[model samples]
Target chain A: DTAVSQTPKYLVTQMGNDKSIKCEQNLGHDTMYWYKQDSKKFLKIMFSYNNKELIINETVPNRFSPKSPDKAHLNLHINSLELGDSAVYFCASSPRTSGRAQETQYFGPGTRLLVL
Target chain B: DQQVKQNSPSLSVQEGRISILNCDYTNSMFDYFLWYKKYPAEGPTFLISISSIKDKNEDGRFTVFLNKSAKHLSLHIVPSQPGDSAVYFCAAPCGGNKLTFGGGTRVLVKP
Candidate 1:
């Protein structure tokens, strides 16, 4: 069974266009995260949510907005997409978000976005 | 600045050989560490982890070692097979549930 899954595995769009990526996790996790892997292959966390509440928000552009409908779903919406936004976006989740420093995070296959 | 750093960008090893990947961290407060492996067109999967209280943790052919004094961690894959080839990342939780990840080390196990 797929613990985590993201829609639109591959996305190609023109500059200034808007797009959205959807993610879902069926592991009964309480915390979810969104990560971006740039061209340099550096993976960085952009946003995180615990039980459908925003917890972590990195220095991401305002054009990018994340919405968590419930504990199992998180969606990313981008406005006026820029070329630099092209990268692989990954979704991850953990069972709980307390003092469990040793908790394991499950990741999705990733969505490859290309802004032309 | 990047708290976690993986110096080796890539490593190629022969089948049945051993592969070692290293990672360094700037903060000493990081007492827990994790290693993730990612294949092409796929997300990273949890491989192994090590806590500061222990020096080494082993799981089958994968072993992770931690050195608190040097603030370093390493992942060792013994008898690495071709299927073992993937990009490995070392990560540490900064605060709460946020994980600070290293750049990553790509391993190519040749058969």
Candidate 2:
């Protein structure tokens, strides 16, 4: 079974449209995160949820909001998607009690989004 | 400014040889560093890591060396195999949790 899984492995939409990407982790992790990898291959953290509560949020646009209904599920919703939203979005999770950052991170296959 | 950087875009090594990849960070608060290997169309996989307290950590053919004072870290692959060919990225966790990743370096292990 996949430790971390994401829906809509590939998504294509036009600007001004709305879309969402869903993610789940089966690893019993308390901390889950969403990252965006731009064309330059820089994976930047957008948001993190700990037990369904937002913990870390970078300077992401207000249109890009993340919602976590439960500990295992985190969904990202983009309003009026822009062309710059085209990139690979990855879902990752790790135990919140981890004392060390060296702990392994479980990542999903990633959802590729394209905005025209 | 970029906090974590992997200046070398690529490195090539013949099979059975040694391959070294370097990374540098500006944040001293980063107590742990990690290396991830990624293939085309797939998410990155954990390779290895080292804590600030340790100077080096090794596993099988892979080793991670961390110099806390210099805020530099490097990954060494001994007996490099073609299967090791992939994009290697170095990352550090800031504020105790959120990870910041480097741009990544492509490694090619020749057969």
Name the candidate that leads on lDDT. Answer: 1
Tens-digit per-residue lDDT, B16-97, candidate 2: 9999999999988888888999998888889888888899999999999998888899999998999999999998877746
Which stretches in model 2 have alpha-carbon errors above 4 Å? A101-103
- Candidate 1 residues B9-91, lDDT tens each? 99999999999999999999998999999999999999898889899999999999999999999999998999999999999
| TM match of model 1 to true structure | 0.97
Candidate 1 positional error at A16, Å = 0.6
- For all predicted structures, in order, the TM-scores are 0.97, 0.96
Could you tell me the lDDT of residue A57 within candidate 2? 92
The C-alpha lDDT values of all candidates are 0.94, 0.91
Each candidate's DockQ:
0.78, 0.71
Q: Score residue A46 of candidate 2 by CA lDDT.
A: 94
Backbone clash count for every predicted candidate, in the order shown: 0, 0
